[model samples]
Target: MWRTPLEQTATAALFLGIIMSQIVGEGSAVKVLSQPGQQVTLLCSYNYEDNTHIPQLSVQWRGPNNQLLCHYIKHKAYQNCTRGYTISYSPSSITLTIQHVHMEDFGAHVCSVSKPHEFSDYSMELARMSEYVTSAPKSGGDQSGSTWTLIIFHTLLSVCM
Candidate 1:
């Protein structure tokens, strides 16, 4: 009967350009499906006419609640990355690695990058399979198949958006 904070944040992110197609090489929305405590990576990549400007770029990763998870500035990740997450950036891409994903980590993730002339940002949704299974209607009706089908459809649709 109630929506999770993750759902609310995802909706807000969509309205705030997080769902928009970015100028990145990869697809705009990256969806990562994982178990409860598996490693997951959210990839944020971009390309520019010039590679020399890569060093001047700044990248940031935010959680589903819009909390700052980590940031890359001056070619180094901020202190937040030292805690449990690892962020690495190359000239063309930035990757945020969640060493051990938890339920709290299952939701929308945002990656924002800014350069001199190009700025790109988008959101990625990370979902857990258990939630999908356990959160279904408990009326003894068969819905797992449909639930997975819907999830896939929406994931593909969001990426294309």
Candidate 2:
């Protein structure tokens, strides 16, 4: 059986559309800190074919020791936060506030957004601890104690997940 040229062209166009849709479907990137402790907002944006339902957005702050300090899930009024950290969000952004800034707060933080069937994620890092604070005190000791709390919290997240 011989197929018409128009049919072949339509089939080729459909295949190309499907491939392009998958490539540009959903993705996100965490913005670098324009400045530390200045109410930094991490943005997680995604593209979907349909927008009939409200999407779920999750944001987390990780400490220097790869620990989860704060987390927020959409629709939940309460947050899971570490002792010195707070979590909040808007429609398209999640913000983590670190009070009385300390060295342990320096590390990679991740922001993730998800819908019923699709999701996106991103990561950012604070290169130096001193960047968060202008003046440095002349004191040195094991800072691990302060960060230990975050580590424990991260463990709980792992178990729950």
TM-scores for all predictions:
0.60, 0.46
1-161: candidate 2 lDDT, tens digit per residue: 21743333323332332333344443322223223333233333333324444545555656657688777766565479888677766554556656544555555666555556656665555433222222222478554643553354334334433
**Model 1 misplaced regions, further than 4 Å:** 1-27, 49-53, 75-82, 130-161
State the weakest 10-residue window (summed lDDT) of model 2: 128-137
Using lDDT as the measure, the top candidate is: 1
Residue 120 accuracy (lDDT) in model 1: 76
lDDT of each: 0.64, 0.47
Q: How would you encode candidate 1's per-residue C-alpha lDDT over 72-99 as one tens digit per residue?
A: 8854544357367999766776788888
| Index of the highest-TM-score prediction | 1
In candidate 2, which residue pairs clash?
none
